[model samples]
Target: MKITGDHQLIKKINKYLVLDTIRRQFPISRADISARTGLNKATVSALVNELIESSFASETGLGESSGGRKPVMLLFNERAGFAIGVDLGVNYMLAMITDLSGAVVKKKRIDIAELEAGALTDKLKKTIRGLMPHVPASPYGVIGIGIGVPGLVDDQGSVLSAPNLGWTDVPLQSILAEEFGVDVVIDNEANAGALGEKEFGAGRDVSNLLYISVGMGIGAGIILNDTLYRGFSGFSGEVGHMALAQDGPLCGCGNRGCWETFASEKALLVNARAAYDDAADADAAAPNLDTLLSLARQGDPEARRLFADTGRWLGTGIANLVNVFNPELIVIGNRMSLASAWIGEAVYETLDSRSLAFHRSRASVAYSQLGHSSAALGAASMAIQRFFSTMKATWE
Candidate 1:
């Protein structure tokens, strides 16, 4: 009986290692796990069997042979648990459900005009309840939830003045954890966007990069030496509020001439409205930015000019970022990249004029490949990474 119990404990330890290996590098074979982890083939096979029995992993058919019998592949059982990623935007909330491999199985967009703490919490609870029907059930249960709120979230997940959301001192993490009965992580949206780009998008391979998310407001996610650089008080990447133009437009953050006031989607929309209101066309009084984008796409000279000006402002910001950090890449995200052709030229123009040649030569700017979905995608990746990290920590 003592020997049997010891064997069971050893089996459990090895099984967890197998499951973790599969979670980190899925679509792998037992032999590959053995080779990478330096575990004997017999032990790997036995641990894989336990994981399969516990529904933590599923066997794939086969891999290419190398002068031996074909190896059976394995992947994490994505259906074993569900994770939710919420992008709490100034104008809307985007909630997405993704599996273990970061594939979005379902998504919902909720319109939010006012961001009263109580009302927003109620809405979030309802949104999660509404999404419960879509979640897949398995052994480990829904591991955790991640939220990307557009503000300075402290380490404990308290909101510190999300000006656009009208939030202050909101215990967002605790509230969500109580409601969901799971772990919750809340972070700045731009930081989340940076994490997303590094893990699954543009900065996957680059050691140093900046992901600039120009949404309703401008924000940046900085990755230096391949890690998210959240400085003191988790507010390092709040570069949007940096002073750019003296005595320019006042920002909602109670600042004058903030970079976001000149470079954000809100800025573009505000400028478009001003331009439209003064246009010769009488039908230009509509309050839709998408319409403005469409008009610009159709060769409206005024709209094109507005986008170019916005792009230049964005490029100026990028030049400053490059001058400071000297990253290898800069990813322009949100709807800002919608006008990439125009913005690309403006970005190059500013870089050519202002940035030092050495810094300019090192950085290559590009539009976010994932486009507007970068934040929510990053939130999903956050959930997965947190889960694996927690598992590894526990094992250690």
Candidate 2:
């Protein structure tokens, strides 16, 4: 028993160190790995061999020689084990299969109406199973599944409430675990997107960054000091529902003039449609926002005006965020940023006019490079973190 325990402990410790080192600095040679991890050369070589055998890592040609023969470089196997990441939103369900490196191997998207948990969970289960074949078959199997939900999620992976989804206290994680037979993680979509950006996108280098997901609603993911800051109850970043106006439009969160009511896609579309209908000009005849943006792209005056107006409103919200968080970068995501060329300019203008001078100069608002995939990619990252943390725990 003692021998087996010691063997397992050492094995886990080696796997933990190897995976950790590779994650931070991949495409590294075995000798470099030894130096960084303080593992002896033979131990590093043995661990590298084990990782390669287990399909968790692979050789990536050779590195520049120091003194000895050109050493083979090692990297985390992006094609090794897979994880499923799902962004379940009010309008769509985006599912992606990713490898240990959080690179999307396959993606699936489905449009679904906002509904109760029972029906939604059923559909989600089918969607997840449908995506499994897309992930490359591997010995480790799909490590687990992570979900970026559109509402408040408790620490226990319960959907405390998803007003958009008409859910309250839904055990989404347990339901998914039961259906998929794997570990499940649930977090707010915006928070997940923030993690995605911080880990793999534009905010990677920033110590403080804010990811604002402007979809059907508004929410933010905040990274402070290079770590995700989930406030007490994991609800710290609920900035979208922050009241921006005392008597603004009625919000889904039972508030008036919430930030999202002014800045979200629904808000932009709503106001744009209103502006289009109210305009006495000839170009205001069209009421649809998508059509308006299309016309704006073609130089329609009314369309341009509508986008600019909405962009100003969005900028107001962003300015408030800037004042509060003082993040180094603010990433705008979701469908609205598609019109970044027009709206982005307007956002900059509003911020320039409204925010404190210091913040305006320090922070740059940019479109999300990950596009709509930020949430799913972030979910995959959660799985990767889980995998590494588990390995570390086993070692400890």
Candidate 3:
């Protein structure tokens, strides 16, 4: 994979290389970008000028030179454009607007009482409309919209199935694109969460990582060689549906003994309700997740036991991932991660008992640094990446 001969292609690649160098090392001189990318000074200057004209980069104050005259520093212009990112959960939707650098400019969340596709789409459109007016004037106003759905999505952005939302064969990307007149990118929430963590959270330094989103259900996002590993048909990383028992509890995906049935937030809540029902003094009503977490933090024995059980189950699934993927890091996120203090212990203990010594030793488990915002932030980052790639194409 050497890029040979095509002069235009070479120039395009060099332009992106220089842009990336400047992005990573901001307020840097053209000479430094040339030095870092091994591109000649003249080429670097040309690319820098193009970037400035395109409003992608800006010239800041001059920097002290080692020998001759001071050099003008270049900065990646984050406000050149904006992107919208949405995390569509089963019961709620989180949306955020961000600049090219992924810094969130505005954010909103709406709770959904109905799961119908039409209703959800309506809410989504309304939210986008509200955000649109706030976007500042730029070269590419609202360059794109990226969405993370809790379901199986295809390469073309069709949501194949979102069982929790009762959606099937939903053309979310096309719908949004037609409605808003902007490019829309869609992916599974877990995959988006993985990207979010990789770009801004716990997995930032690692090339091989796994992000497990454990909310109402569980799903995993896999990253290999610092790239998302979407398998054939873009349907990989559905770890929640992996069978763990032959005759266990039924799962929403029409399977029994699925991993999520035993380890997800839904599972934890079910277990908590059962525990409450068993106690003589227990109230008839079930406690919410926050209340349950509070009880556990207060040393409620039953809550502790339930979380421990879920943690062990979570660890069992993670062990399988470790043995198969050999990831350098595993990040646990979504609502369930609030119990990581207990779940983490059980995960480690289970890995120690069940996982291969070599495989388990190489991987470290961590909680998500971005918490609930991971998916939305990741979606925005995806849009930003797409915008830059499109910009590169025009350069050629």
Candidate with best lDDT: 3
- lDDT score for residue 291 of model 1: 75
Q: Model-by-model lDDT, in order?
A: 0.83, 0.84, 0.90
lDDT of 3 by residue, 318-357 (tens): 9998999998999999888888887889988997788789
In candidate 1, clashing pairs total 0
Name the weakest run of 10 consecutive residues (lDDT summed) in model 1: 387-396
Per-residue alpha-carbon lDDT of candidate 1 for residues 75-188, written as tens digits (9 for 90 to 100): 888777778888888888888888877778888987887678898889888987788788876677677888998888998988988987778899999998998888888888
Model 1, residue 148: distance off in Å is 0.5
Can you give the TM-score per candidate against the true fold? Answer: 0.89, 0.90, 0.95
- Could you give me the TM-score of model 2 versus the true structure? 0.90
> Cα lDDT for residue 75, model 1?
83
- Model 3, CA-based lDDT: 0.90
lDDT score of residue 261 within candidate 2? 83
lDDT of 1 at 288: 55
Candidate achieving higher TM-score, 2 or 3: 3
